[model samples]
Target: MGDVTTIRRDVLTLPVADVGPDNPLPPLCPPDEIHRPDERDGEGLPRDMARQIGYGRLRSLLPERLRDGYGRSRAPRAVDTLVIENDRLRATVLPGYGGRVVSLVHKPGDRELLYRNPVFQPADFALNGAWFSGGIEWNTGATGHSTLACAPVHAARVTAPDGGDMLRLWEWERLRDLPFQVDLWLPDGSDFLYAGVRVRNPHERAVPLYWWSNTAVPEDRRVLAPADEAWHFGPERRLRRVPVPVHGGTDRTYPRRSEYPADHFYELPDGRRRWMAAVDADGRGLVQTSTDVLRGRKLFVWGTGSGGRRWQQWLTEPGTEGYCEIQAGLARTQLEHVRLEGESEVAWLEAYGPLTADAGTVHGTDWAAACSDVEERLERRLPRAGFEEAYKAWRTAADTEPGELLATGSGWGALEVLRAGHSLPGTPFDESALGDAQAPWQDLLRSGSLPEPRRAGPPGETLVAPHWRDLLETAPAHPHTEYHLGVAQWHAGDRAQAVRSWERALGLAPSQWPLLRCLAVADLEAGHRERAADRYTDAFDDLCRERRDDGEAWTAATAALGREAVAALLAVGRTAPARSVWERLRPATRRRGRFRLIEAELLLAEGDRDAARAVFDAGFEVADLREGAEAVGALWSRITDEPLPERYDFRMRPSGGGGA
Candidate 1:
């Protein structure tokens, strides 16, 4: 190394709205829809493109619990951060929060190479329901955002390719029963920050895999990619091939051109280099280039419409610069996942830093020439062979045992190691990582019976993977055992057995709402709408009665389940009961924007159009509103015959306008 590389553990205190605690409710029921619409079969698209569009489906968020316990509440807190720097750039990483790279500063230019979010604010963006707006996010597990977005990952110091201290982050992803690692380093005198990512499937069976390295940068720039055509997926769930740069009669390469959030997945030809860059008016901004293993590159823009800008303000401090995301992924689109075979791994290396191209051509009208200019510059900056050489050199250090643990995440990884009876070598989840939360699982591994909770509290976090399910099945049957066994059975796609187990557990326990909720899903899937509503009503009732302290935790559980319960009731036209459930919610919970939306729906169901319209007139924002949900626009058309107000206009596609 030409200059001494420095690595230090530190704190980054920022104004952050806490993610609070995760919802205690296990995700037993399916979402409203699968949401992935595959219509490409007869489209005569490219063979690889056809194979990659809507390739896999994750039915529900199982194994991982729901994380809906966050809101627009803010405070300042000190976050654990790790700093790594060389002569040209400084990188600040938050190991406690998915090992996200929060900031990358080009020291020579004193310019931030990535969107350094002004504040930390969690929203309902991730698959697990808590996601912040900025930084380079390492996404794994199933799509949307990674389940690890707001969670911790194991972190330690490892040797870099240049023989300096590299920061390594690894974690056991509960959703897929796989372990992954991210190693970050900076070479002496190099302006780029290099990250090597690896996802390993230690299981003996095939697993669906998803990986996306998302980099956020200021949106007031032109994004350049190598492709002349792109796969455009918007909030409308349609994946259509469109001409790059000039889609919908305007240049889509610029983020400001779009009216709402959309994704343009560049269709780089086979055997071409994978890269994308966002350049400012001066043609100087961040560029992210990755090895071939990371096949896809994407540009996600949340445009400057009223609702889009409102969402930006909702996610962070007011008046901060908005950002657009340039992402690299394993598949061609986020709508698809590749098949990861048994006992194999997928790995890639990504480099991110500043790139300056000819400003005039980069912002010119000729799209092909614009892209070629940036490509030429990128090739000169970091040749493909140079990136491959770096990847080969990093592999030698990938298995080097990590030293000096910087932070601790969940004990789940350690528990996995105990069960597998093997070591992951470099990214070891040592026994030291195990804690009180892991006590029951450890006892289950030793004695084959999960220790039943002594308290009447809600069932704690548990595993639903096949191995854990097998252990549970072999144990003596009880309410507790049957309840968990049913969850595992459901996850394994054995609905009949799952229902039978939950039914048995419900009869014995009589008051366990979790079992009732699982049964409700079984009933729903079976087309027993009335039965499902009855079960949902009972589940909500049982949980409400079981609230011991009725504090924030209980309130959260009430709000989450109550929302679901009311929706189910209304689905079956049981508006009376739905209204009753809404009435029973705590006052503070009822005041939430989401609950207000529900209240409006309840009023509309009761033939009170005026009341429902008033809810819209008064204005409310569903902070956790789903990405493609038509709730706001659809509800507006029903309540009043008026144009969809600008503040509530979140539609990304033109199909569903302000109409009924």
Candidate 2:
């Protein structure tokens, strides 16, 4: 047989002999006639009665009390049996529970099984099962009440080639004699699977309960949840970044692909539900599943990123590919009736199948196509939306109190809207109309809001804030704001103002390493070696702490800061201290191409010309790592005692010899 084939019939074919008469056949088993032991000699007198049994004694093993409890007292009994015969496999499904076959088999040859009952162990549930530990607890003293709550929870399971005998089962006892119901299914046969729950108020009196799905999957997997926005929380659990709506509307979607590794809990938009898929890159077929349709279900996706967060292992396996499962239920609560009621409605699922490797690629392409179509529809609808009226309002807003309205925070929205307007084929706001907001425009330019700040004359010259000073004043103060303001002041020949701004920033929040480094350099320029040394110490301390806290961010920040620090220290004859700091930093931080030249400088300072030459030689081996234009110019200045290169030239061509 070829590697790929599609079977036409819903039922699969299985080898009869492969199945164990004592145990249930796998879901994938194909159907065919096979020999059996003595027919009915054990219970009945008939000798031919046993040859037709497919699931063997499994059908009889299900407790009759359990079956009666699941249905009406006098309802017609339904046959729950697995049959294998004539190259076709079949299982009888009961009607009461959505007519779903709780136990299903594919072909006899297929080794996948739909359900199995494994012995329960608390330790196994604690360590291997999901929803056993650290979840919201609920207890109802035979009093039925309905309540819904939400809490962060986790669950996991491992499926290997061996241990087919082990199976997982969960049971919920009714406290208030309310109807306990659950809908479980493996919707996707690949990488991800999900279970959804819904609780109904069967009784006239209200019920309360706490519920959650402690769902777990193999470590080292990733999750994809549909999100319209995201939020960031700092170490203190304080809101770092507010929920910023994913810029593209719901219709304007992008492939939910992550460029960087992360594990985070993303909330879906209110009123709209979303599905999540867990993926293992190295797995065979994607194990996908989803929740059953219920009156109300809230979806959530939580996992870790490539970074070493506690939950990252669930989303990403260390050496091998992993798996992920989605658990859906009522939120979390503490009340007894509430917990019991919630448990009645809890949903769980398990799926084992090979995942298609190119599923993500296919899904991503489809998303892109859909988004393009949506954008086109939006574009067609724009002409009828009274664009002229909106443009007039925008222009009016831009004219009056132009500075305040176009200030830092306010202008960002307006800027985005205005840019969007420009992209449209027929926009009401003419270029000249946009230019009419010049006062606000000048305010932004004067405040250094533009990408590049305007240059000013020599030192000691009288200076004034640009025409848009009010607009600049309205902009919020961020860490970079003061730094940029200082740069503007320096260019305008107000050295004192620049220094004061930097100092003010440092006083406000001393842990800002970039500002500290800048302050240190300014001190060095002013011949304040002692002050510079103190500033350097502060910067080094903050960076070192950050490095120890998070290696990646620390490496990035250090690489950027270390280069400047090395140069400044060398200028101030503090090579020894600089060298010591460099040593403490990670090798990844120093091996950057930019640092190679710095290494040469440090060697030259130590009077090791050969070592410096070797560093330069290594740098030359990488074509792009050759000495930067500004560095060469600096060397020429040192050799010939010529005037320094122009500021604009220096800025335009920076020494790009740094590690990233």
Best by TM-score: 1
> What lDDT does candidate 1 reach at residue 128?
68
What candidate 1 gets wrong by more than 4 Å, as runs, is: 31-35, 38-42, 52-55, 657-660
lDDT of 1 at 556: 76
TM-score: model 1 vs. ground truth: 0.94
Q: What's the lDDT for candidate 2?
A: 0.31
Cα lDDT of model 2 by residue, 12-80, tens digit: 221111100111100111111111222322343112212212122111111000110010012222222
Name model 2 segments beyond 4 Å from true.
1-493, 524-534, 547-553, 617-660
lDDT of each: 0.84, 0.31
Compared with the true structure, what per-residue lDDT tens digits does model 1 show for residues 213-241? Answer: 99999999899999989888776666788
